[model samples]
Target: MSSPETFDIVVAQLGDNWTLTPVVFENEDYQLPDTPAPFVSVEIYGDFFDQASIGAGERDDNLWREGGEIFLHVMTPNGTGSRQARQYAKQLVNLFRGQDIDGVRFLDASIGAGDPGRSFSNYYAMTATIGFERDE
Candidate 1:
């Protein structure tokens, strides 16, 4: 029903493969843990909706089709190459590809290296985009 709920569903789908918890909401302030390597986070970045039909009334009731884009951010240990980060991103993609969560169908996923300007030195950062939709 909400972004946090959707993020929890996604994390559950990731299962035992992922252990670290990163920030889930965009623009939410967060502090990173001082632990070791392999930090990960999931967030709902965007959403879209379409009205398919309108009911006949003074105030029309609308049937809506909704969808959203989920982003998974992964950071491996320092000195790890982008390959490792990409591998982790691939795993995240595989987990959600063609799967449905609470009636939300995951359509596809794309992975890529994180922005160099935003990433830290020696840290392998990658991001994955998951496309999902649902009829309501």
Candidate 2:
């Protein structure tokens, strides 16, 4: 089974980049203020596996890929127009697309507005799903 630590590393790195908005992580406790505002929710999915081979014999040349995805939930106030959501989505794409971090290669992200699977029930949302892989 793949350990979530791989994705958590990405999460940790994002801490230094949260100046735009407050970031809420999955399974963490947070105290939302009385006023509703824009925020981002991060979710991670890690998939690490061992490939079975015939007669490779643990060769150093043998390569395996460990892949994962990070989901960015850009949540904004419902009363506001979609502009704020789109702006956040753009920044998220710019941050993750074609980037290499700690050996993880992040690919072009797929984005969608008003995602049906929003992390926050009360906010209008745009979701950015980034697929990343690392050579192991």
Find the candidate with the highest lDDT and give its number.
Answer: 2
- Give one digit per residue, the lDDT tens place, for model 2 in 27-68: 878776677788888887766645434366666456767777
In order of listing, the candidates' clash counts read 0, 0
Off by over 4 Å in 1: 1-5, 15-36, 55-61, 113-118
Top TM-score hit: 2
Error of 2 at 106 (Å): 0.2
RMSD per prediction, one decimal?
Answer: 3.9, 3.1
- Against the reference, the lDDT scores of all candidates come to 0.66, 0.74
Mark the regions of model 2 whose C-alpha exceeds 4 Å error after superposition. 1-5, 50-55, 59-62, 113-121
Cα lDDT over the full model 1: 0.66
